[model samples]
Target: MDRRKSLKIIGGSAIGIAGLVLADWKWQLADQLTHKGFFTFNEENLISSIVDTFIPEGLPPKVPSPDAKPLGGLSTGTDKFLYRLFEHCYEKETQDIVKTQLVNLDERSKSEFGKPFYRLPQGDREKLLISFENSEIEDEVNFFKLMKSQTIMGFTTVKEVMENYRGYKVAPGYFKGCVDMPSQA
Candidate 1:
């Protein structure tokens, strides 16, 4: 081939290789930033739904919350909690354990319920969770406990849960020790 043609071919190959590298790097970076390497889009989505099951939306028209407002999984920052938990709090090994446990849960849900865990009927989902909690497998029991406690902690800590769900108001901290003495005088 001529020099110009050879140059063109080399240029095209270099461009193609560079594009692939850029694309791969972009994908990896996005994955890590999204879930700190513990989850992909689907996995993150599944975890969100899983958290929802644990603390579903308590809204009106069917079954209302005590205050007739929505206060549950979405309000509790369940998705954000999981993302932060795996991203900043947990080690990679713990994250991997959580991921594997969730994967196994989904697979079991698929096999037994004919759908993934998120798609299971509410009753079935609750039953499955209870079974896991009572399971003889030490690891399964531990995973259940961890999931429940983290989710509960996350749910309870959010402002929505504190103010709306629990009906707690911010109290002003003040001391009026001398007011009664002044009145008596």
Candidate 2:
């Protein structure tokens, strides 16, 4: 299949969860993610690296990666992109899910590879995520579901992917109300 087709498939299919909480209007809490007190840079970088792993900057199988821009993934700011979604969009219980998932992933990586998730080689990182995606382990399953959804959401917003793959119009004309025109007698 073509690159755009692949992007659509990936974006549409990754959101495997039933009731995702994505609030477009309530983005104010996103600012808190960048704070040092509540959120450290180390955490953000780790999350970002995981996002990058989910969709890496390389040719897939036999398909050539886009030469113009990095097709999708962390180059689009997905590393810290889910901060708002977790902090604001998700309910308290769901927020706990996010935290628990990240921590579990870090621990798993260290236990398996003797290094942090971000420090692993790309192949190993992908293998770990793939294992989680297919694993029956409760925490792994939960993290995969959440990360896949958020990563796909962030991937589609990357400028190149939005325009080239999804056809997002950055400068579309203004919206006007559909008013009934006076009927001709």
Candidate 3:
């Protein structure tokens, strides 16, 4: 073939290859974004159990009030909140760390108590979490702290907790002016 024809054919082939690679990359990226939020069904259940342990249901009122009904983490959808938070807000490294730690927690529970974390008794679950909190491994300790803080944050921010447990009024019905201010003592 002549030089010009040969060069033209080579350049066209290169462009075609480049276009195919780019299209493939785009499709892969779209697939990842679409599937990103999903965790295995077992993982979801495990997270729910962990959050419930952090704030178990049917806590007694501190002041023995008949009207009080303490809200628990799972009851408030804290586990679902945590899942979204991790998927959307956390960095990829942090998300991976959390997933890894969750698996590790289950493995540790199985080895220690002969059951997965979600199947362990409440007391055993608490004991396992306490061990994580006191663990010398930095990842384990960090995971415990992160889970505890996130669980509490999610539980406290629920609408039921705000209205019932905290007596949080969105708007005060009356705002009395301090007309009769006490004299400076």
Candidate 4:
């Protein structure tokens, strides 16, 4: 080929490659933005529903303290906490299993109850979760167990629960080693 023809071909190939790379980069950025955390919006909503079912709203205080608020998973942001935990701490395989199981749970609810898991009544939701507890499928059983434990962990670790329910003290006063003991009457 002539020098000018060879140059034209080389320039065209480089431009095409650059364009492809730019397109791929833009696609990756959009994907990352849409999936900000480990879960998508719908998956996060499913998690919120599942956690709420595990720890429903308006639970009366265990000790009836005046400052105790009605405890619930959603109110404590347990779903978000779980999301961060899975995103940062869990293995990729575990995260994929949990995500798949969440979708499966919704599909199961629709198959059996004619509605999505999140839309089911509170009692129905409980019954469905209990069914998972009794499920013979290993994935179903594992998913249920993981979700239950994580929900409890997330709920108990929240600031509200730590302060109001558990009476967690940040600093328990100064120590004094030379105090005189009072005599018992």
**TM-score leader:** 4
Q: After superposing candidate 2 on the true structure, give the runs of residues whose Cα lies further than 4 Å from its correct spot.
A: 1-38, 58-67, 171-185
Candidate 3 similarity to native, TM-score:
0.69
Q: Indicate which candidate wins on lDDT.
A: 4
Model 4, 1-185: lDDT tens digits are 49999999999999999999999999977876776655886688788899989999885537447665677999888988988988899999899999999998899899999998889999999998899899999988999999999999999999888887788888879799999999999
Better by TM-score, candidate 2 or 1 = 1
lDDT of 1 by residue, 25-91 (tens): 9998887677544476657766777688789886634432445667677666787777778778988
| lDDT for 129 (candidate 4) | 89
Name the TM-score of candidate 1: 0.65
RMSD of each: 10.4, 18.6, 15.3, 13.3
- The lDDT of each candidate is 0.78, 0.72, 0.86, 0.88
Give the residue spans of candidate 3 off by over 4 A. 1-36, 62-70, 173-185
Q: What is the TM-score ranking, best to worst?
A: 4, 3, 1, 2
| Regions of model 1 farther than 4 Å from truth | 1-37, 59-68, 165-171, 174-185
Per-residue lDDT of candidate 3, residues 1-185 (tens digit): 59999999999999999999999999977765565545765677789999989899886456236776666787788999998998899998888889999999999988998998999889999999999999999999999999999989998889888776678888969788867977897
For candidate 4, give the lDDT of residue 2.
Answer: 100
Clashing pairs in 4: none
